[model samples]
Target chain A: MKIRPINHKKPSKIRELTYELKVEQVMCDDVITLSPDDTMNDVLRILRDNKIRGILVLDKDRLVGVVSIEDLISCLVDKGKLNEKIENRMTKDIVTVYSDESIVQVVNKFEDNGYGRFPVIDRDTKKLVGILTKGDIIDGLLEKLEIEYRQEEIHRYRASHIFEDVISDNSTLIMQYHIKGGDFKKAGEQTSKLRKNLLRLGIMPETIRRVAIASFEAEMNTVIYTPEGELIAKIQPDKITINTIDSGPGIPNIKQAMRQGYSTAPDWVRELGFGAGMGLPNIKNCSDEMKIKSKVGKGTDLQFIIYRRENET
Target chain B: MKLSRIIQILDAKILCNVQGRLDSDIPMICGSDLMSDVLAFIKSGALLLTGLTTIQVVYTAENAGVNVVCFVRGKKPSKETVDLANEKKITLLTTNMSMFESCGKLYNNGLIGGSDYEN
Candidate 1:
């Protein structure tokens, strides 16, 4: 369960790591399929009987459509679609797989396109071949977990070695910046990078997670509404502390911001399907201690700390 | 459909580690386009609807202890993402409806918020 420290040298060259992960290395072949000619009766029967969410649609023995429980439910509720054609009802313009792509490519496909089931087809024949379901993707993720966790453990071990040499009577201070507002794509960048650094530093796992959550929230909040903020972390011998400072439109009501339903995100953020306004709440939930300061016109700052484990010392 | 029923309906493979699979009937499921809100707000067993396709989505699910994720708008995950769900025992599904339409349909069909039926 030891994570290997990512060779820090590799980070600055993230682009170089792009092609490292392969697709076939992670996809699962165990998937289910349904032909396009199939009826709602058939699809619903399968969905209901099997307790599943989706069915791949094949036409002329080629991958064509995908049907899901939600689709069937919609049909049944309307009451006019009992016998409607599945091709008409099913979702078209489907995303597919060739089995030869990279794992990152697949991951990107899932993220960008909103697909969890892909009919793996032969490039030439284009047949409705093996199905790739979300289960298949989940399998891929878990595999990465092992790989990632190992790397982290290794990194932690190396960090421990470095720590021994440093003989830190105090925690190191990591200079940080508030994440820019409206930068969803880069939301996790700071935290993920910090996590890797911490792993390599051999910080305790529990402490690492706490820091991760706190940093992650601050990063997300910067994007949500702050317009700008910096998240600074300090690795002290006794505890870890993170401070997020921003200068955007500040929270008029910290109490309301702490509530789960309270959010000030725009329509686009919602369309991208987050900003349910849980960032601050989750941060508070994860951190052992939390502090927030804000001025209406001056933006906000979030400070949180989690102590080291007793046995680790 | 209930989460348990969805599992049974799909004969789905449980790909994540979960403790209470049968305690509640999942009605009124909201499908989103993001992974964060799903992780933060949605309860356990509430089937996720999102258009995002990534290992991070699965990671979010695993971290949140969620059991199932359904990609709508026909978003298909690659082998890597599928593989992650399998290892986590989280059920991954795909659908074709857009965010708004999908939720409306599910909501209309008794995937009602806070509506838990025994069936």
Candidate 2:
């Protein structure tokens, strides 16, 4: 096996784009706050009802300390003070981010302080306008990256259609196909198309084979499980990326699904020679990088990348 | 072992034309109907032997980097599976021998298991 050196000097475009966004754009403006004089019972109720980790404390329109679930739990265990005033037990030394500040600055503060969330306050009023968490920042970055990716895709599509052979050798090729559930007859169609495209692009046989297998497995998974799904393939100069997004009834246990021989496919699907539960593992094996994000009832998003070989022209 | 030699040893019937680069060597052999186990254990250029005759078997073989698929116990694949195998350029064969006897024959004929059983 050849060991490839890690490219540490390259900067991520997403991180650069996120640095240009303001905190106000991504912060949760609907702030859930508590008064300094509120009892611990109020904090517990608000945290549980809202499913939040912490609540901002306010005193006469001014942002005061913040009370986190940890503080409440510790107070409850150490003193059993459910009725005590929050001001007495809340964390007073709070770090905050201004709404006008760039997300990069907020990220820096998060890194330096190791805080899960930071209260977002207005510059002039110094009033708590929103709360920003690490999850919010990540979601914001992903959304931004997705928008940029889509815009680039649109440009590429127009360029390919309008200019034809004018497309440079370095230009990326993208293809998308929709797969319907219980579509056994058309299974592997998308992968075959992908394989043909890769071959046309002069990708190495070994790399093409891996991409074919990985994309086929992903395509089969969508056809077998989800009601409908989309498979998107992007061929770049240095790598190939495949993204599969499906609608409805996502995998409940991704970990178990990845295990060998673990199948939730009904007996009928199994009789069709699928649902041996190796789809995900096969995909992972063929791709250099794989990511799976799934919601129980919502949907699943799978993205994988295969790096091109050094000798491939 | 070469694919042609395997054909002679197992007395398998070639369901499709074994065209293109027939002299390519087969590194090892794996026998399993469970697609999951096949994907987990298979190596590139290996021969897959199973009794399962579904399109998924061909898909699994293609994805797992297995170039040849031989169905045991006289199992015949559907037209869809055969068409897919042809499209993927995967060689397909079927034999009347049971899975155990087929595997034993291959082992005795010097085709080792693809996975590391010694570890």
Candidate 3:
């Protein structure tokens, strides 16, 4: 019946506000509790069945502790003790909150207290009522953000959108990219940027994924093997294109490079631990359309395209 | 401990938004020296204390959405790093203790490691 002025919640339409206001208006009222004696199998099943991150451990009617997924993993992996009694390893120190707390206070409790999930208890009853998860918070936050984004779609400057500007209304543009050898440090920067731009343009998620995978591979190639190179990207309403042009010592044999198992990355690079040599093939695998043009002296250029579907195009 | 308490515990100097308004009561923590291992294993908002200070330290923290970074053992970051940390607005803390020692203190004082996200 009354509207309370709160902190700087973003201004939005009523519909937009509702999407972000994911916190339970009535306060979360469901939580799972565990007795220390609950077995590993029992707890595991609870986690699986309820799809909960953690459960509160209670001794009689009083809360004594908590158990989580990572705890179970440690018991199973390091100690080989999962089959043993669960009570012995269950945490005695449980982090929790009262149901009356504001959602912001609940969020603040997540970090200040240092636990990612908490048992929500009805203070008067001291009864575990529900679980609060960091994922839940993020889910709420993302909902708020996406709602905000949908209201006003805007484009920002980025290297990958170069194609977006050049492509004509009637024609689609596409390209592929290759990273020259010895450019490892700059790897993924291009594809990563491409991913950002696509999201900003409000492109379909799947289309962005395709361009991301292709560009990532090409960028890695330039860094791992090419002496000099640049990633080329093309954009069209019908399709998004990306190309990797490398002037490095070219792939001596196209067939060998295309082979899935063929890799030429150096040992030192691998030791720091990267470069499986599947870079090009992986890119090829991800693109809707792919082509490789390589010459021994001139180096390599890769072209890949992801077609935007007709209706959404 | 409240985040303010941690500031007291380590005699740590906080950079950016130390206006006695920061959240210090961390429910869980993950301590690792190798940045990648921490990135792969850590949950969305754990307090991270490590010995490394590469730019990827900020990068990993940003992606993981880690709220805090405690640079242990007299490790001072470059000015560029502080700028990055500031830009991201994530908490940056400095303490003069070895990784093992710092972690042990926090653990002994009751900080849980690992997250619950069971499903």
Candidate 4:
């Protein structure tokens, strides 16, 4: 692909939100339907009462056709009878979207077909359940985003209040998290949480960076090489210490594992941007002190420390 | 430098919504496919350029506090990766430029890389 010069648009959060929201979540289920036997005069009355631009023609519970404002205008233009049957004037080749489908697809359909509204059908039942308009989508997305913004504000407020007033000669914060093996999605979550806590405590950015990196690598190793493990961190006034204990198959060669570019990770793990044989070396490089002990067929315990020194960087 | 300026200099395409403003300045850039190297060296609020598009790349960026990640060599990540980036509020970008060329342009534009901080 050739580089496009300076015209790339960043994907909007509203656009991504569409992928997470279903059509039913935003659709108006209180649909006003015009039966096949209803006349053009009935359409005019329903359109005026509901203030809707498009109306669906239903035969009992099943949708048969759609009538738009243009159709009504055409009837007036032709000086046609207002008492004419609705289905005869309605568009038969109507397009629809499933209620369970993401709004992203609905947006695409809107663009492709140039339709003002879509009838939302239940995917499993194939029953017409609701009607959706552009206005509904915009309102739904805005409401969801507002809720998210409020929650984020609350989360930031909570994170800022890291420690409460307490009297003690020495206070150490201890955090423990269990890491499940083979769970790539949650591998670094504990470390990320720790980093946030450290930030809230007003620790130096550089110190927190080092501690986060070392702990993250250790956590990933436990998730990759063992069935399960526990990460425990002790935060002292002068330094931070982390220990990872795993009861899975232990490493037979600690020296080999410590070498850069030496990894025993499976091919699948390698494809996930890890297992480059740099985890142990990275842990060693970031920590001020490190040690590891393992027994074959048993388990392993790895510990590291990072001193909270001022002006170190 | 400003992330928008970096986008202009590298001809990059942003792939996700950023939590913060794009006009904000970043201190450094780190180019690496190995997530461990990125974790070990990258400073907070720096931009990361890598060819790896896995979910772990996003995780590494989160752990390291790197908010902006540019996937080099025209590498676009999967939907899962992009979704994760969006959820994490990290900005994702892609460019057709090679890792070497992208670094050179950013360097010429007065951006420093990770080596400047390594002791």
Candidate 5:
């Protein structure tokens, strides 16, 4: 096994790009679309020639369905005729994105649907205008970042102003993330974002890890026990404080909850290797200060703070 | 250890197509099915070995900054899990070896666990 040193300095522009860019700005407008009347043979040729996975099936400028490589393979394996109309094999239940929508929303769509690409539609005309792939988002962000880099003065201002706005006396950078219960797929996303923001801010890696782990436990608790919750982090110069507030069945006993090996998580959660009754204990262990406020049948507000002190760790 | 060498030792199959990633060195290893425990101990860019093949594993890897995840015991992830891992740029591998055997082999090959890793 060969071990390599970690690179703490990672490019932070992509995070900002997802938030700032739009689908139209990133999507490929020269879509290689096919008409529904087109045969599977045409799809095969276009996909192969274009080196693309999927092509939109359009009916007189209106998207009707989408055909992909999987569909093609299935057709071949099922011994279906190549001359068959693509409309027969194409999936009609297509999910699309409005051109004006932010890239972040498209990202969530990709994450939730697990689809390789999405057809971009114009809001007013409801016509397919472009196509978005995960690769497009990456290329678009990199392109934008490169342009921004060339405009060094604007880039510096944009990056530094975030800190300058919050680093003043008694000012705190507050970040909020919404947590949806039973949405296991989206859980821990907030913590990932928080970790990146902390890294971009040049926070100590040890401190950031502690902050992330503690918040992740809290985030998991919210996902496990609540119908919905919110994670709010207040980053100060000396400490980072996190509060996870949920309007769900609150903990009945704080003492028991804080104890190791005490969890009320369901069997399903345990099957995923969670609900070991270690969440609260892990949170308490990672943070310097911790507190919980709850009312039965009401909600729970869990808060923890990790101080940014080198001497402490 | 180099990810390629680790793959060779564990006899693992690459689950995702992420070019130029396998040649890099992996500094530490952390084996656990419990993601919360992983979050508690994982160092940045460490290789995670687990028997659990679920989307949450990728989520945990993303949150904890684990760049390489190898599923042991021939566990295979769902399409969603693989897609998410690819999007996050985390390498996914699957091995027929059990978690203990995978860890033992990696350890014998000089890959230290994250518990003993220090800056």
Candidate 6:
């Protein structure tokens, strides 16, 4: 790979990029909210129709509690609670994020609480302005990484004989490995290899650390969930990318899988000290870019990238 | 704090010798038996003190960048746990102190929790 010059002077640029990613920039402002008086039946229909897990319990424009599918499932067991008002069953202690808050802080909250989603309120007005999900943060990070990668590409192009070298010697180096499912013994093998390669290439310690965590999580996901999978690592001068493609019972609900604490692993897997449903979230947090696509009964493809030259401090 | 200092304060037994890693700096201590919670909040190079005595704890600690694990309340880990800890280069310790006391001692010794972000 053609290495690029490390920009030591603009060390704060990376931090500036992350801190500028406000909750509002990535939040879904057009939230599907339900009034407190709405019946559980109404909540059920909305959730089913939208393929969503939860609905915000709003009192007009004001923020309130959240009622989720778990609540509905428990209420269904009682049968008589079907017509009960959502306010009676909704969770009162709402955990929320402010629109102006940095994305890093939002990620910290997600890690600390293990919540699937959070209501985003205006800092000044204290009114519910949007809803932020793990998927939103992933998308935002992916966008930022893409922009940074493109800029790096431009720099590489300017620094070299662009078209001819691009055709003769591709700067990106690719390596692939096959991982078998239920192979807990060999779970982190590829991650260790990737880390070694990055270290040999002299990547920054912090960047290598994030890459190690992200690759390990993705590798474990494949080992725990799929029958078999291929892990692809691409090393570039400016970034390191890992792609996990698995063939197995695909995740039916990608949204749900992205949520923290949502795991489909068997109980025995939890005994292995995994399956807390933090794998994907942890991967997203460590990566500068992440994308996941899955088809029911088909397979899953997960891709994440970490910038090699990012500031450590 | 150093791992040696942690061992001294907790009156722990080293189950696995990690060579010079005992002299490595530990800025944080997280105590939890639930591997999920540990994975969620652990920082790099932090010390993990848990009551969980499974090989999975060692695996979790390895994945989360934790280099030292202390089993509290005198809980003994399996042979597989110690073996994995050795392979992964993670120092293993066993202490008779309760989880609360172990954490308190570390905190009293200036090893802080990893949650530095504002709540």
Scored by TM-score, the top model is 4
Q: Write the per-residue lDDT of candidate 3 for residues A186-284, one digit (tens) a residue.
A: 444456555655666667765665566556556656776777687777766677777777787787888888776577877755442234555566667
- Sort the candidates on TM-score, descending order: 4, 5, 2, 6, 1, 3
Each candidate's number of clashing pairs is 74, 0, 35, 0, 4, 0
Q: Highest lDDT: give the candidate number.
A: 4
Candidate 5, residue B57: lDDT: 91
| lDDT tens digits, residue span B1-119, model 2 | 87888888899999974643245688788998777567666777888999888887877776667879999999898998898887777889999999999999989988899665332
TM-score of 5: 0.63
Off by over 4 Å in 6: A1-169, A311-313, B21-23, B34-40, B53-56, B117-119
Cα lDDT tens digits for candidate 5, A155-214: 445643565565556768889999999888887788878877777666777898788788
Please give me the DockQ of candidate 3 compared with the native complex.
Answer: 0.02
CA lDDT of each prediction against the hidden true structure: 0.65, 0.81, 0.64, 0.85, 0.84, 0.79
Query: On residues B3-58, what C-alpha lDDT tens digit does candidate 1 reach at each position?
Result: 66554433344433222333345654646556665554555456777777766576
lDDT of 1 at A57: 77
How does model 4 score by TM-score?
Answer: 0.64
- In model 3 chain A, which range of ten residues has the least summed lDDT? A1-10
Residue pairs that clash (backbone atoms under 3 angstroms), model 5: A1-B1, A2-B1, A2-B2, A3-B1
For residue A2, give model 5's deviation from the true position in Å.
Answer: 31
Cα deviation in Å at residue A34, candidate 2? 99
lDDT per residue for candidate 1 within A1-313, as digits (tens), equals 1212232223322322223434455544555666766688888777777776788776655667888777888887888465677887888988887766644455556666676566666667665446655565556656666677798777667666664567557547565655777775555667766776776766766666667755766776677777778888887666788888888788888898899767887776666545667778888877889999888898787799888865554
Quote the positional error of residue B95 for candidate 5 in Å: 1.1
* After superposition, candidate 2 runs with Cα above 4 Å error: A1-170, B19-24, B116-119
Return the lDDT, model 1, position A113.
66
Top DockQ prediction, candidate number: 4
Q: Could you give the interface RMSD of each candidate, to one decimal? A: 10.0, 12.7, 8.9, 4.2, 5.3, 10.1
What TM-score would each prediction reach against the true structure? 0.48, 0.57, 0.41, 0.64, 0.63, 0.56
lDDT (Cα, tens digit) per residue for candidate 5, span B64-92: 77888999999889998898887777889
Give chain A TM for each model in order: 0.50, 0.49, 0.47, 0.72, 0.51, 0.46
Question: How much of the real interface does each model capture, measured as fnat?
Answer: 0.19, 0.43, 0.00, 0.68, 0.55, 0.28
On the 0 to 100 scale, the lDDT of residue A9 in model 4 is 42
